[model samples]
Target: MAKRILVVEDNDLNRKLFCDVLKSQGYVVEPVGDGRVALESARSFVPDLIIMDIQLPNISGLDLIEAAKLDPALRPIPVLAVTAYAGKGDEERIRQAGAEGYLAKPVSIGPFMAAVKGLLAQVGAVAG
Candidate 1:
């Protein structure tokens, strides 16, 4: 089966871009635009990885990452955080919140896919 990836991004264009790229690479992509429903979607989808956007409208992606890390069901899933407004310490903060990977936008396809594959590979190794 193809690896499942949940993409949580507010921007329509960015979300579509990520979804398209991942789907093209044969991943089963679930795109979520609302931060409020992200976790619920994740739980239902049971994705292998999550690609989160930091600057969400209502809730911060960092908080979502923290919540996922705390949840027993979601804890095992690897998260790759993507943000447009990256600050000096933002990456560190995202890492602290339990995201395994971080990328600043506008993200290139190569690096984006690399991070996704790397995180999935780690999961495979752990489960292998």
Candidate 2:
């Protein structure tokens, strides 16, 4: 089966773009708009990897990552944070929150896919 990827992004265009790219690369993409819904979907989808946006409405991505790390069901899933709020020391914060990797927006297709594949290889053991 294709590797499952949960895309948690708030922007419609970014969400669609990520999903399209991952789908075209043969991943099973589950897209969600907010952190709360992401949590719910993560349980049902049981995705191997997650691409999360930091700035979210209901719950922040950091909070979501922390929560996921505490939950045994979602703990093994690797989270890659894709955010536009990148600043000095931001990557450290993201990593501290439990995300394995960080990608800044506007994301480039090649590098983004590379990062995803690299992280997947480490955690999900599947290539992009």
Candidate 3:
């Protein structure tokens, strides 16, 4: 089966871009605009990977990643933070919050797709 990816981003253009790119790559993409909705949608879809914006409405992506890590069912799903916050220490903070990878915005397609493939490999590693 094609890997499933959940994309949580608030900006319309960003979400569309990410979703479109992943879809073109043959990933099943489910895009949500808010962190709260992301949580609910994640439970239902149980994606293999998540590409999330660190700043989100209702709840921050960091909070969402932390919450998912705490859940037994969701803990194995890898989350990659895609954000504008590429400031010093931001990558550390994202890792500390349990994100498997980080990508800063405006994301470069090549690196972004490479990161996605890497994170999907992680899921395969754990599952196998």
lDDT tens digits, residue span 29-87, model 2? 99998778888899999998999999998789999999999999999889999988789
Model 2 local distance difference test score = 0.91
Put down candidate 3 lDDT per residue, 1-128, tens digits, no spaces: 99999999999999999999999999999999877888789999989998889988778899999999999988889999999999999999999999989998889999999999999997788888
Q: Quick one: RMSD of model 3?
A: 0.8
lDDT scores of the candidates, listed in order: 0.97, 0.91, 0.92
Which lDDT tens digits does candidate 1 get at residues 22-90? 999999999999999999999999999999999999999999999999999999999999998588998
Q: After superposition, how far is residue 14 of candidate 3 from its true place, in Å?
A: 0.4
List all candidate RMSDs to the true structure: 0.6, 2.2, 0.8
Estimate the lDDT of model 1: 0.97
User: TM-score: which is higher, 2 or 3?
Assistant: 3
The per-candidate count of clashes, in order, stands at: 0, 0, 0
Highest TM-score against the true fold, candidate: 1
- TM-scores for all candidates: the values are 0.98, 0.94, 0.96
